[model samples]
Target: MNGQPFQTPVEYLKGVGTARAEVLKKELGVKTLGDLLQHFPFRHIDRTRFYKIKDVQDDLPYVQVIARVTRKEILGEKHTKRLVAQVQDDTGVMELVWFQGIKWVEKNLTAGKAYILFGKPGSFNGKAQMSHPEFDLYGSEAAQRKGNLTLQPVYSSTEKLKQFTLDSKGIQKLVVGLLDQFAREITENLPLYIVNKFKLMARADAYRNFHFPEDANKLAEARHRLKFEELFLLQLKLLKNKVLHTQKFKGAIFDKVGPFFNEFYAHKLPFELTNAQKRVLKEIRQDTQRGVQMNRLLQGDVGSGKTVVALMSMLIAIDNGFQTCIMAPTEILASQHYQTIKSLVGDGFIEVALLTGSVKTKDRKIIHQKLENGELKILIGTHALIEDKVQYQNLGMVVIDEQHRFGVEQRSKLWRKNVIPPHVLVMTATPIPRTLAMTLYGDLDVSVIDELPAGRKPIKTVHLYESSRLRMFGLMKEEIAKGRQIYIVYPLIQESEKLDLKNLMDGFETISREFPLPQYRISVVYGKIKAEEKEYEMQRFVRGETQIMVATTVIEVGVNVPNASVMIIENAERFGLSQLHQLRGRVGRGAEQSYCILMSKDKLSADGRIRLNTMVKTNNGFEIAETDLQLRGPGNIEGTQQSGLLDLKVSDLTTDQELLMLCRKCVEDIFAVDPQLAAPEHQVLNMAFQDKNAGLSWNKIS
Candidate 1:
């Protein structure tokens, strides 16, 4: 019918005429033959079981039955018209109603005729009823497909679609129209060796069985093959990008560990580095020593000392006579890094400067001049560091904190600041699940600081319903009496009419009334507050002038107060797992034991309960991250780009982790054997990369 069978427009299909095809494209994005094939069923239902009308329960998703049409009638007229049919089984009677497509549906109803019915049951006046129930002559195509005893797929459809005869049954028919063409059109994307080795179904058979299986076993096999293919192709493309990036972009070599690094480590180091930190530093050291530009992702929990690792790596660059910069997502973070690094280096061992939008023009110009003249050894700032006026003489490394906050384009600007791309170390406190990291940051080498510094006690976490508000306040008072500050965070800055949760301003008022000023000063900060005011409030908390800091998620990343011992999150269920973990990290920085109280409403959704329970159970950021990945699913996780490789149709990162790991290993094994896919057996993968359905445009999340 066209250049390629799969590429043919859906309008040319057997059942889908121009009108139906237009509806399909507009509603479900099913335009080409391939798009229709890829629209998988969310679930399948058994057709063998038929329930008696008397046994029909509202709790059941859908009730199937064989019954006789006792009476049929059309009510109202024109736009307000409806068709109602009363069906009777051996035990009882049920009403089947259709509000839309009344004229066409009325023609199909025949009173006193035996037929099969399928629909979600609802009770009306103690009678079982189904609106727009599916029906056919008792034994004629009752399963909706011919000559099959397997499960019937239940495809999702909209009310608009049902009006145009494009319900789930309609869509199934369209798919069935293409069944005979699968073997002729669906070419094998995976090599024969891979298929045989993995015990995978053939490409054509997989597609057919996935849509309409002859049996449950065929369906399971089809799913396994498709899921593996989705994950494998994505992994293969990621590995290819990693190889190409390493080859295309040359890295600045930093082989020496000079005075700046050794001086701090020997005399000025604040504490002993954890083995995890040391191991991560060694990984960075190895990445930089290689000639290829290092693109490494450094992951650590809030107090895991990633900044120190980053500083040490930068010192390696400085040792090799190259300048380095650390960029943060916010100005507050930039200033904090500057202060921390300055105190750690013990005044003038190595020059460090901060540049942000709030920095005065005079100071900014001086920093810019120093940077270009090679007088500034280390620069930490927000986006201001990437301005056109800010140029480095020999920028060798760029460390990005909370790298997900910055886009790919902004990061690329730093690479352009030098002739050759600088070594990149992207740091994130949000611990990503291993499966997620492999797919999201697969192109970059990853190093994780999993262990916290010794002697730092884990923050004690607890969950409390809103009924225990007084108890939470008591804990806050107790903490403050012990000379420790407290952090009270809210989900919203102001009252939300849509959400019935406590807001920051209301919380501040509540705390002000309870704690009462002069003796206990509280700082209120949020996104809408002026930057200077927020900083001043934060400084007050840091200096112990304010015993309580009432704010929203604005301080989730930037604020680090060793004296802040208690973190009370109002509507904690509203916050995600990683966010709760980051907030918990704000405390426990000091020797004093810290506490994190998660406050939620009594009525919580299952996901909300899981999130709160996870926060209360352990402080392991990675463990919390894995649970979050499972709860929210890969697509809903914040900061993770939802398109490209993450737009997984067949493979779910949550439940299919084993397959994900296996597929990644397969990609690794293939690359080990033939990185370029030049081998005859590997050529199929190269072709898959070109096909969207096979590989789906393997791209990294920015």
Candidate 2:
């Protein structure tokens, strides 16, 4: 069965000697008949019918001719022999030529015999000719064999394989031999209703015909079934992961909001919290109060007041006699969060501490000791928060800003800092689209701060062609003269190994040469710099000592200088829409009028043009996120690899927005009735989920 278990390639199957088998393994990755059977065709050549000799043209690559072999001649040396045969049909006469393989042609073609020759038709002296055309031998039964050619599948071949004469026909022969003993695995994954409703072909038959199809209809059916299965399985795996998290993991619940919230609201902070902010805070308060631990994502647009919400939540943790830690991607962001809350939090009640990798040894020891004891109420730091030495006495909640920038496993390490896993409140300035949020962070409850605080003016976005660079510089000079800071950003820092750096670096040098403001200073930052150096440059800009900051996207997420009112992003076409939006968010932070000028070269792609135009039209981050979802699709929107998010099959979180909504509805219903998918109709989904992820069930920490 299946050709005697395929021990050695040469002895395992027919037609393959040691020499040919070695060549097959080396050149085609075909070590056995099994490999040959699975080597699928990229595309097929349709030969349902052929054109007559008279109808054939040089442009066409195939022609049919009922030609009589009027003459035959052999030429060339033994090593490089050639065969020339002249044939005439009812339409016209043509020469059939062959090189290197003349002996084979000579044995097959007999003079004065009528045969059909199929190949590329060309011209020689105003007459039809074919170079190395495929021919069938004439026999007494040739009359019965005359029929239309059907679609022929084409297999990719290398020169070595071709030299062994392993053409498409040879592959077909191998497939036929293997199929004689074929025992297809029966897959009963999708529900019978789903299969019937979708008009899917039987799984076993689909696999068989997918490799070797008899007709176009069968091939189409096979492809549809396979694609559907691939997508469905992928989605099932991701969704099941979320289900496992919900059922298996236990979290620390801190649901009481009265004590800490009452004190903060009684003070009636200077600025008012928007209605959207109040609603989200309420959701978080309720989730924390629940018996199970709270894992929630607080998604807000740029300048939507997310920091304040996080601070309030941390206060609740502190009031409950537990410690809280806020982690940011960069030291600057962490320090910024600490500074923003230090005054509002009104020190002494909560012993706030900051710890970073660069902290002095003496300071580090004190901070470590304070954190180990219950002396520290609230702690803020970069990755230093997750360090082994920095143990929290009673860590109850963790607030991570720009949460997607982290590895999910790395973030999980912070939860282990406490005896009981801390209630995680992941916050993001990036406005995640609803579809993406449902799939990527499906395990976590989500809250959105959709409204912006009053009196914060929307940034005015504009697009300019590179030709307007000189005028744009003049405008920037005027803005700088008025004591307003400007951000001049290039796509890259230096010349890249692959890309041309002439644009970005050249622009940087030109700016240094041209605009030399005597009173104000300029700071530059990029990827090549060390972390400390980046912090130093950003600090200079933040302190108002530097009015112009020339940087790349390194400052896109971090380095919030509210005083800066002008943002100029060069070669905007080179950046993605989301990135450009993030860069735009850097400005428009303060009360002053902010402008974002996107400069691009001519000839923008349709997608790029839409991205730039959308930026120019909208100021709402949610609207921009929705547009980003529509344009970039789900992969970039949710960032699966980095997010450790669920992989959705058959569902594009963007294009399949309606399907996502439907899936959400189904999730609610299933949880209501059959939480574990144990119902009869859902049995297939349950088994499919169980059968899948068998090997990947290890704890995420490992």
Candidate 3:
């Protein structure tokens, strides 16, 4: 690391002294010469050709041209300087106006002489004119292009910094001068086989071309190579972390389910478990008993019966005399899970306690005492479960519902609660794309329930334009007449805004005024409302006290009202595909034929159209999730990369799904043959890994 050149401050560069270096540092965060080399361009403008004045549209941007300055006129006095220079081409003559800097323009634009001018062409008073045009004498593409970067790298800076004369050109000048004296070629970090196979440019060549390219093609190639390396290194780091964690942690052994599972299976409750549920449970059982801590991700579409499998696993832990704690994102979900498990397990004195932030003072104290004493075996709650005070005597397993809703730190806190971290199981009803699943949960062993429960009905999805509002209402009335409750959900403009959409409120008012049933109550719930109020509204809908519920996406994740058969998503184009699927999952929980009406405005983008079409085509959340990944790519799912899973650049986990399979195969093959990458051919692999994990590495390379 110390051997590399241009690692020193920019002030030490050949052309850049203290003054310019201070401006560079303050403006672009480029204190070192290395920083300038890494500052890649946002985009580039092509000035390879000059357009004719006649050919240039009024709306198009103008370029430098050799034109005669026909006439010069001043329109304003001293302080308010206004001047115009009419420059003529063979085809036409356009007015070049300079409102503020007229004196400088007049001196340069001598009448009857050719001068180059650049600006945007605009029509004013039926004549083409440009404001404060950039002009130069005796200039052409070949001559002016030498010092300027071929790609024209745009550095990010603030307004104040720009005022200090630390612009892109200044940064470029400093970089070029430093590189001449200090730049030394570094060893290529990729294996020779990979470089040849991918036809990637050499690492040093890529770095040079990325900063000061001779052609657009070279610049593009350089960018692609760099982006690929960045993503690969990040992935390598994540995968390595997972490997280290698995090596260090050993989980509780639950190998023999002979007496416990056998007795439970003998009675078999009333109905048999689905093949999918059985398969997932077996996977979890195998993983848990393997001695290594089971960090498995359970992904299932809604109605796929993920909860049953989770419960069965908890039962296995409980039967083995180990306590289990299930954490939910919401109190309502916690309460619901507690009810389902209590009835299903029915093991008297097993001690299942419900703990949430909303629990009363005395009740909370009692729950806390019970948890600390190890009397509460399967304690379920929201984040309050990990609230410092809640202690488990023998916490064997931890199940997290809606895994994305919780922070990474929050999850880690729960794992370290016990001496030996509990075997972690993250459950999500929102099915993730397979490639994403690997990258995101590369650290965890993943088990999925792809098959839906046998008796569960598939929700029928339909897309409708806003023009069909009257027809949609008619269809809703028909569904309502059948004694089925309807949920009309409004999409929020922004996730944070409590009252962006009037649709939720308007829909509530409409139901109360127009569609009110004497016995069929209507309830409204949104993000603005208190959590207790939200729960109350959900409870009413659940207990069948409220026949219709008008709400926003607040009910997207945990609200489970099976009786609600109709889901009308207003302005569906505004919502993402995964979100729409989750909201649709809310309905179809019951037996009656469920339908989701996606009411989108006619004005929809191509991606928007695809999203709506994908929803209509399938009820499978995994399929929709895959489509969503393809459409949106993997920047951030559920907004702002909450999962911290695939923060990839060039590697599209969605589109590069097949390529990832190949990469995984390669990883397996390499690890199988040479676990430590110590082989002769793997020298470059070591280099790549070192570059990728530079920040985390403490090992010295000798």
In each prediction, how many residue pairs overlap at the backbone (N, C-alpha, C within less than 3 A)? 1, 4, 0
The predicted structure with the larger lDDT, 1 or 3, is 1
Give the per-residue lDDT of model 3 (tens digit) for 1-702.
123454567677776778877877776666766566666555555544566677666867545455778899998677776897788899887888887766677676778777666667787798777788766554556346443223455555566656655566555665566556544644566567767877888777777777777688998788767655554454455555566677789888886675545665666444578888888888998888878888889988887878778877887887776788899998768887888777766776357888888789999988878877877778889999888888788888999998878987899889888888888889988788887777767667788888877677788999998788788778777877787788988887675465555667766776677665684578888877887788788888888777778888888876777778999998899898988988898888777889999998889999999999998998878888878877877765663375544534234566566656655655656666766678898776665554422221213210
User: TM-scores of all models?
Assistant: 0.90, 0.78, 0.82
Residue 355's C-alpha lDDT in candidate 2? 84
For all candidates in order, the CA lDDT equals 0.85, 0.74, 0.74
In terms of lDDT, the best-performing candidate is 1
Record all residue pairs in model 1 with backbone atoms less than 3 Å apart, i.e. clashing: 251-293
| Top model number, TM-score | 1
| Backbone collision tally, model 1 | 1
Q: How far is candidate 3 from the true structure (C-alpha RMSD, Å)?
A: 4.9
- Candidate 3 lDDT: 0.74
